[model samples]
Target: MELKLDTISKHYKDKKAVNQVSTVLKSGVCGLLGANGSGKTTLMRMICGILTPTSGTITPDGQSIYQLGEDYRELLGYLPQDFGYYPDFTAKEFLYYMCAVKGLSLAKTKQKTAELLALVNLEEVANKKIKTFSGGMKQRLGIAQSNINDPSILILDEPTTGLDPKERVRFRNLISDISKDKIVILSTHITSDVEYIADMLVMMKQGEILLTDTPDNAAQSIVGKVWEVEVAAQELRAFEDQYMVANFHHEGERVRLRLIAESQPTENAQPLTPTLEDLYLYHFQEGGTADVSTD
Candidate 1:
């Protein structure tokens, strides 16, 4: 099952939300990482068939999804960035309603409702109203609803918004478990969300894909470019002005800075390994360039 995008673009009155972006997605988890307003949502909407592209075509295998119509949607499950829910509906009720809407049989709906609730660990509050649930609980319920149909292509937009560290880990593990034979496109600003779970990392910037590769392979793009340096508190401002700082820590009177630069930023700078956050920060800064080195 291959999903292909051919020069897909989306434009508003005066702005181009998505450039002529083209990529082939296969059966595995593809993490869409980008800063705010980077056209991640627009691209995801187009892929889910909720929004038509200004140009280009999206096809599953060889036929356009629009042409396939219901046949295409039947195989998709999308959890939007802003998922709407009935405030009065309980977790179980919401899943049941979603299953019914997806055109499942009553027996099948019941079975899925029970299964999803447990899968997301919402069984304890299966009968609690969504209005009374916490933010994390609501997010979990939204994920549960999306999986009611057991879709082959699952699209999740910022699925870890309100989750704590523990919940985030649980959600990541869940997605990893289900992505074996499925195409999962997860869009989020959190790099850690896709750091270990995603088989492919797609980085976007200014309405265009900047890089796409495996995690280990992508980090290699900035190999020997990330540095860690300890500077006096008074030098922090100058250090930040000189490099693309990815992280900073205050250690008593000194500051530890993790930065990205073409070469060492200071005499005491030590080369360090690059992580997803380092790569993400490196690509978003002024001197960042698209270097997709998969091999």
Candidate 2:
């Protein structure tokens, strides 16, 4: 199934939340990378049919999503950035509730409820209230609920936001497993979330689609531009002011810095393999011509 966005745009009074964006998504995971206020959420909302575009159209297999109506929703599943969790609902109850909302039959709901709880590894805690679950548990439940309808398209917005390292790994693995034979749009500014799993990367900046490429291609676009340098702790601030510093680590009394540059930033700067994280930081900064302000 081909999910296509044709010059999709969304405007809010004076702000252009999504600007003339167009892309074709296929089966597999597509990472929607952008910082806060870059309009990732707005674009996703429009794709999900929760919000109409100011201009342009979205279609699945050459038919308008709006025209498809309930038929379109039947093939789509979404887990918003701010997923509404019912604190009082147990894991099983929550899944059942979502099935009902999706208009599933009672028999199907009972079947899916058991299947999803097991899929998300929540079968043991199936009776536990969501209020008592950890952030990761809730996110697992969130994913499970979205999958209850066995959708062909799954859109997850910042699904790993609050998860710890281990849980984040689990979630990424889960998403990887779930992407088979389905189009999974994973929206996140966190590069780690998509670095290894995403089949394609759709980057956004200042409410516009910046670049769309495979993760390797995206990182390679900045080849020979990534650098690592070791300097005194006091010199760290100087590097920050001079280069697009991606990250830094305290190595003893000295500091190890990872940065991006057009050429050799310094005589002692060692060239390093570029990564998605570096690319993400570079784009959000002045280097990629994006203004990362929330406005």
Instruction: Go through the candidates in order and give the C-alpha RMSD of each one to the true structure.
Output: 3.8, 3.3
Task: Point out where model 1 deviates above 4 Å.
Answer: 286-295
Q: Which residue pairs clash in candidate 1? A: none
What are the per-residue Cα lDDT tens digits for candidate 2 across 159-209?
888678888888889999989989999998788777879999999987999
lDDT tens digits, residue span 1-295, model 1: 8999999999999999999999999999999988878899999999988899999999998999978998998788888877899999888888888888888999998888888888888888989899998777777788788887778899999888767777778778888888899899999878787787999998888899998899779988999999999999999999888788877999999999999999987788999999887888787776444222220
Candidate closest to the true structure, highest lDDT = 2
| Regions of candidate 2 where Cα sits further than 4 Å from its true position | 249-254, 286-295
The number of the candidate with the highest TM-score is: 2
* Whole-model Cα lDDT of every candidate shown, in order: 0.86, 0.88
TM-score of each: 0.92, 0.93
How does model 2 fare in lDDT?
Answer: 0.88
